[model samples]
Target: MILTDTHTHLYSEAFDKDRDEVIRRAVDNGIERFFIPAIDSTYTQAMMDLESDYPENIFLMAGLHPTHVKEDYKRELKHVEQQLKERKFHAVGEIGIDLYWDKTFLRQQQEAFRLQIQWAKEYRLPIVIHCRESFDEIIEILESEKGDDLFGIFHCFTGNLEQAKTAISYNMKLGIGGVVTFKNGKIDGFLDQIDLRHIVLETDSPYLAPVPYRGKRNESAYLINVLEKLSDVYGRSKEDIAKITTENSKEVFGV
Candidate 1:
């Protein structure tokens, strides 16, 4: 069965010592596709190098992450624009408001988010959102910009049923990840109520590792743990879940 990890930072330094082995582990476990999200201009070269190393499996995205928004955000956005003009990317993402860590750049974050959404529409590409402690703010902007051209995945979604429905209303697929396997990760409670077509799997790896691996560094191969949890949550076979979620990912990323 082929599985898609719609959001993962394979270029992250966390896997610097054994990046190839990490990728091989995932591929051997049937998780072939890895969608890499952009954080800032600093990681652009590393991301390119990753794609260069594994062109068949790596898909790139260009955008300034909300947390990275700062006084020099304008220059960063320019870099994103230049990258888009120079080549191809499957999406513009891992962008949105993140108020959890620091609210100092709240206004800048909102502006960056809106500008990136406009860019996504201009390029006719999907957006992968990174939302944290700002669901209301995120939904408000999405409401103002809602339309046919605005569509993507809500990466690492950790909201309630109403928020999930709201995200779906905006043409976004819920990106389920290792959190679903956590005993207290509430999304699992109501996930089955939402149709499988609106869900996609992700690891956000080197980050939210699934149970049996929780509290440790995450990897794409652990996506199997997530798949197994989803299978139990939705009462479907693991292969079926893989097929449906991977198909859902294709619909969002257009790959």
Candidate 2:
């Protein structure tokens, strides 16, 4: 019953007070793997410290998040490049266009996204995308870059059936998270139609907490809530969902 949280910010300040306890609770409940995504150079040390504390469970990624793309983005990308060269990361991710908050940085976000994808290809690593209201924009880039070397997870996927199929076409596994448990989170409506092989579990924790915990800070242990929802959605046992999604994660992260 091992479960993998393919995208979570365990290093987030939200967990600063009781990080160990939060992680222990998840591990005890079978969510043993936590893949951490990068936002910017600001959290690099914190991310490293988290991995140092839980070497067995923590897998880190290096990339500049789309929302974080600002005037100094080039400097930030340099940091991402340096980290990738100096250490091992399971993926290059949490990167993509995010037009939800503001459209001001859309151009910079697109450039950063494309550059990161090229870096991922160069490093021979999977990419974990952070898409938000920019599906059409992201899909255009993906369509142009589709290839054997360009593949990864579409983190926190909240798209329609056609979008889901398009992401799968680009070798991306849909990263199902707490949103699936929401009454109005539409992904749940068509999830079962997509094969379990193309899906992976996540919490995006400290954010997007599942029902019963929604509107509150989320933790990896709450992944059980997501697993339960998915079990109901796909008509499979919880253990089977855990096994399949964890395996799907391993395929993407190569761990």
Candidate 3:
């Protein structure tokens, strides 16, 4: 069974001490494919360090995260462009509207999101989005900016059925993570409605850890919990869920 962590910030400081061990443990347990998302220029060096350490198992994505969109967003975007020109990334990602924290820079966030989406289109690469309490607003931008080439994952998808369908219409795959394992993380009841083709597995590690590890730091090995929960929801075995989601990820990342 091939399992893919389509979205994870292995570059985060949370894993500085045991990052290699965490990845090694996950790989031993069959969580091989890890697609890393870029936050801002702040973590570019850490990301490069991680990719250098694990070149075969890890892939990188470049973009400015929405929450990181501040007064100097233009410079941050320039940094993103600079990195893109210097290296090849699997996608332009972890970019989208994040209105959950503060609504101060909503306009800037939208602008950055649109611009990054345009970059993804230009590079012929998929994108990974981080939508937080801004699905309606995001839909508006996607409707306007999304073209034939715009495609990627809706990282940490917890949206409703209609939202899922709408994102699908925009060629976005739902990045399923630990939320599905939460007692109150309500996507499971309707997840069966979403075909496996539009879904991919992710851990979003050191953040939304699955049940059992809920409230603690998440890791790639804990992806087994997400996969197990998915099997229960889809009425399939863990191996089957792993195979299908891995294939679906390959379809999106083309790896």
Candidate 4:
């Protein structure tokens, strides 16, 4: 079985202590692919180092995360554009709306989001979206700018069935993470509304860890919890879950 964690911060400082060991555990449990999302230029070196250390297992993406948009977002977009032009990236990603943190950068966030989507379309690479507390606004932007050519994943999807359908209409697959296992995550209620083919597994590690490890630090190794939850929700074996989601990920990242 080959499990693919479609989104994770393998370069996160939180993994400084024993990152290798944690990754080894994930590998032992069948995780073979890890997609690392770039937040900004600040973490570029760390992400590069991670890919350098684990060349075969890690794939890198270049983008400015929504929350990371700041006063000089043009420079940030330039950095992202330069990186995209100079090298190959799996996707233009971890980019979307985040009204949960601050509304100050709302316009900037939408600008960055649309600009990144343009880059993705120009490059013909898929995207990975990170949305929080602004689904309506996010949908608004997507509806305005989205077309047949733009497609991607909605990372850590926690929305209801209708939202999932809306995202799907935009050619985005729903990235199911640890949220499905939470008592209040609630996405499980609509599991049957969407099929397994439109689903992809992700840990969004060093962030949203699954239950039993909830409130604790998340890591790639914890994807097991997500696998178990998916097995239950989809009524499939873990190996099947891993295989299908891995296949779905390949369709997105073209790995």
- Go through the candidates in order and give each one's C-alpha lDDT: 0.96, 0.95, 0.92, 0.91
Candidate 4 contains a number of clashing pairs equal to 0
TM-score for each of the candidates? 0.99, 0.99, 0.98, 0.98
Which RMSD values do the candidates have, in order? 0.5, 0.6, 0.8, 0.9
Question: How well does candidate 4 match the true structure, expressed as C-alpha RMSD?
Answer: 0.9
Cα lDDT tens digits for candidate 4, 127-235? 8999999899888878887887788899999998999999999989999998999999999988867988899999998898899999999988889899999888878
Residue 224 of model 2: what lDDT? 98
Best by lDDT: 1
Please count the clashing residue pairs in each candidate, in the order shown. Answer: 0, 0, 0, 0
Error of 2 at 189 (Å): 1.0
Model 4 earns a TM-score of: 0.98
> How does candidate 3 fare on TM-score?
0.98
Residue 63 Cα positional deviation in candidate 4, in Å, after optimal superposition: 0.3
C-alpha lDDT of residue 93 in model 1: 92
Location of the lowest summed lDDT over 10 successive residues in candidate 1? 176-185
- CA deviation > 4 Å runs, candidate 1: none
Candidate 1 C-alpha error for residue 161, in Å? 0.7
Q: Model 1, residue 42: what's the lDDT? A: 99
lDDT of 2 at 213: 94
The C-alpha stretches of model 2 lying farther than 4 A from their native spots are: none
User: Alpha-carbon error at 226 in model 4, in Å?
Assistant: 0.6
